[model samples]
Target: MKKTAYFIIGLSLLFSLLHAQDFTYFEKEKNIWLQVYSNQLKAQALDSDIKALERSIKEAGTKKKIELNQLLQLQTSKKKILDELPQSFDTMLEKITVESVKDINLIEYLFTSQKGKFNIQTQRLKILKQEFDDAVAFLTKELATTESQENRDFFKEYQLKKALDFFENASGLLENKEEVLKRTKQSYMSELEAYKQTQLPIHIIKIAILFLIFLLFNLLKYFITKKIDNEDRLFRIKRVLNITFFLLILLMLIIFNISNIVYAATLIGVIAAAITISMKEYLQSMATWFHLSFGNSLKVGDRILIQTNNNQIIGEVINISLFQVTLYESINNTTALDLKRSGRTVFIPNNFFVTNYVYNYTHDRMKTIYDLLEFKIPFTCDTKRVEDLVTEVTLEATEKYMEIALKQFSSLRKRYDMRSREFRPRIHFIPDTKSSCFILYIWYAAPYHQIMELKSQLSQKIVKKLQENEIEFCSN
Candidate 1:
């Protein structure tokens, strides 16, 4: 039993060591790539060098063999220096810097410099120096232009200088990044060493699967676009689908915890948080959409007064979405005939309504009543006689529209325990406080839209009918 336990423990320890080794190697490779990505200046210089070298090689016709021999000798010398690189990566880096400086001196021998070429080279060097100065200025501005002196000191003394030193060293090492890349590629190609037998199939399969996934995604997008004409909805669906698929792919990669899924997830989460924070306005609009979907407060077709810009707009609700609530714009409580003006739609942010007062005129028609018209006449006009005259006149004028009003009023009143008598138009004669006369109050059933017209017509007809009946007018 003791021997078996020892064997198992040894195997576990070996597996753990192998796992750590794999992680460290992978991390180092990734970090190297990241460093290369950060050194854009070096990359550009390398590209320029490669182009120049290529042109020189192409131009050298008769001297091609001699030029090639010189280049080979220089390369062999650089390789010998590289071979003597220190075991310590840091020390190796220092040696690499020294070797690069030596290589720069050797470049003069490889390329013949004319008198004018020296001037051009001097100008180019001057430009490069100016670029470094500009970089320093930008970095200093970012670091030093801080509210706190302590923070500025930290950046100026440590971070800024560290970054500057890194850039400077990288710039020196990358005398020609393109040439280095070419040499590396040439070496790799010459060796052409295949990956381990077990790893080759896995890598091939991964590439094939990635290709298939891309094809499938495009095909689905094509079909989905055809089905959904709404660009916003399509974009949302596509974004969600992409995220889901990406997660699935990541999960598959991390099934054995061999890949950097955790790192990827952390990066994605940070990026997502940044995006959400940046797009706060858009997110607020989305919150308003959620309010519209579940909230029983506002609905389409309801007449509401939205107070924004210190302006009140009472209109019928036309459209409701996440970002905006569109209302068919109203003028003087009426929808315009022309769709552009009165019928214009106002797209207001959903959250704005919550912050401000949203007057829903059509919340429940039962709780509200239409306009109540009350008219005053002299007491001498005979209270009972006047009521009869005015009531008859109102009934005659409103005969066509009264039925509809009564129907609406009846339907509205059913919800409340409102007094049954409040639904009808009643003429009342009350004592006038002013001008020594009693006021004959004529109450009538009316729609809000035609209140002005109805009142004017009723008044005129009552006066005419009274005069024809030889009724005496009361004096103030």
Candidate 2:
């Protein structure tokens, strides 16, 4: 009995050693995960601090410009560290995916204990991207607003340069992001396909039945719509249902987790944001177009004058678009008396609404303007006769046109929300210091297109009348 007991004890000891040897490899893997867990905890703490710093940077006022470089350096370092940590986790995950986990509990460990590590790292990266963008934008604004030359150079060198470089480096990850995502999706898809294999035949049969039913239903709907006269509406419905089917397929991919949907969506969003930032001028112009369109602000055929480059660009607004406004050139940099068209069309950006002041002459009706024109006469001549001659010649020239303007304005008031401003031909003889003559201020109101011609005619007629009346005029 003693010999039998020794033999049994020896056998039990041998079995224990062998069992330990079998699990020894997995035990080391678990230990490695433990070390990763510790690193993850430290990373999480660092991420929290980084977030705090980002908040402070955002809230920092203009006075904090000097400290921006230091803050950026620290932030960049933390982000770099955080960026480095993911490689370790990703390496482990790659092993997990590639290697067969013989022990079922190891898979559970990854889901439970290591899940936070994965999720937190992803969040850290996402937050870092947003923080970096915010910092860059903030520093740019600060640079523009800061009066200090020192601060401007500091921002350009340290803040903007570093931030842009970091962002560019981070985006480089996207170069292989597609490949990584493809592998991940394939790994998940392979698992899903294996799972589906068990009941694939049955599922296929069910799917075929449903597909036939859907096809039949669509055919019925098509026939019904075919009888209706609204072919366009029916065609649109068909397109919508087809798109729905496509979305349903994508939804199934997501449901199976074979799509790498999150990574793909995030990547596309980042790329899209980059594209949008690059094309901000176009987008802003489009937004401005929407604002103008909705506000019913400006329209074609409305005469407009915009002040630009210390010159008033007077033209008839020929065409209005999101990108540009086409203007038929009427009067240019010369004199207002230069009413002849230069035959040059002006293409003005829609963004002109902000920096340049737009003078829309014709809002809801035809363009009519009152030109304040001044002419000098000798102070020795009778002021009363000059005023009467001026008034009479102006009246003779514009009487019929003014009558028409009154009627047109009355009709325009009915059509649009406007009050009429009138200008009857009047000559005011004001005292002049430079010339020994009274200034004949002619307040002429007429159609915009005809104002130049009418003014010329009025001037000639008044001079002829003055010459007949023997009135002396002064020259500048």
Candidate 3:
């Protein structure tokens, strides 16, 4: 009860102090403050702002409930003006003069609390506010009527949205429109961004379609080429296509008529020359192929000896080409006996013909012979009989091999148009130690294989023939 009495005493003192200020100035200030604060509430989003405004009125203990309800309605009329608040702090403050206007009545009431002066200022502010409200209401009505007529005439949803955007933007300039203005501005930016994003897919689709056309053209060209067997016809077709495509590319590169065609053609010519020079070695190889084709140089089957790195390769000609030649080594063979000793082939450059000698055995002469002699007569034997026997055997062997060689030569001569009949096999006496007499020899058509056999056979026959002739031979 004592606390309640003290509160009542303080309230009475506050009321008396407010009354002593002439009440009129306080009344006008109270009305303007209430009007501006309530206008801020209405311009905000509907639900939160309404609840906030109710809470604010309840918290203002100086005002009665009935009086606050009336102020709320009066302030709603000023909501449009309050909603014109600028986004920028400076611009909004300048436009609304919120602080200045709030302090004006307070300062006037503090200086001279007069009922007449307070009423005049209050009436002026009310008139100004009413004019603004009336203009807003009239304009809104006119716009609504225009929209209704346009709806009757038929309006696109897109056009309506555009109009909504314009009106929302204009309404954002009001004194207390921050919340709604910010939301609407975000929506506008999002819509514009969506429109820009949609155009990107349009460009992507155009690129994809162009790529598809290019792939289709390449596939068509591949299939068409596969169907043709004649290389020349295909090459001609390719050349024409290449020329057409070249011109098309040129046209694309130089879209304007003022571009220099001659300069571009010159650049192309330079590139072609550089390519040709780069492939000069290949061209030289092609020339070698031409030489082989024209029957000027040795072909695949010609024998040759290539001196390389201080070593000699005597081999049969196996395979030949513009760039390389292959050989079957013939060094270890008498009658192609060691032909298999070396691997299948050894490749030699055709350009080797320019600096190396080629030897073709089959092409040169067929009656070639290599002869060797081995004597086994004893030291104690009659030297004369041995000499005669050796002579006779060697002569007989020579004659036998010569006969076979001449026959083979005649056959080859006829077929190859080669005069190999002049080749003859011969034998000569050679120096030997006292224990043996050697038969030096030249032979036709006999290889190292048959040389041993022929010597053995002749030795046996000479012994038999000399024995029948009573030839004395010494025993070893």
Those runs of model 3 whose alpha carbons end farther than 4 Å from true positions after fitting are: 1-284, 331-341, 364-421, 429-439, 447-476
Task: Encode model 3's per-residue lDDT on 283-329: one tens digit a residue.
Answer: 56667767866763466555555677766676666776667677876
Assess the local accuracy of residue 339 in candidate 1 as a C-alpha lDDT between 0 and 100: 29
Q: Can you give the TM-score per candidate against the true fold?
A: 0.34, 0.44, 0.31
Candidate 2 residue 206 Cα shift, in angstroms, is: 31
Q: What is the C-alpha local distance difference test score of each model?
A: 0.56, 0.61, 0.50
Clash totals, every prediction: 4, 0, 11
Model 3 residue 46 lDDT? 32
lDDT of 2 at 143: 42
lDDT of 2 by residue, 1-476 (tens): 54554455345435434433332222233334323433454454446544554555565555553464475577468667756654243454343223222222323433533334444544544554454455445545544555356545442344334434544564455334434544654554465455456645555665675587578667867786868678788776776676576455445434443355785576557756975898777777777778766775688787778877786677788877877788887753334445444657999888777566788767665456666567788878888878888888888877776776677678778877887856587677788877677788988666777666777777788888999999877877
Ranking by TM-score: 2, 1, 3
- For model 2, name the residue pairs that clash: none
Predicted candidate 1 versus true structure: per-residue lDDT over 235-267, tens digit per residue: 999987786777666555455234657756776
Off by over 4 Å in 2: 1-272, 291-295, 331-341, 411-420
What TM-score, to 2 decimals, does candidate 1 have? Answer: 0.34
RMSD of each: 27.3, 25.4, 27.9
The ten-residue window of minimal lDDT in model 1 covers 97-106
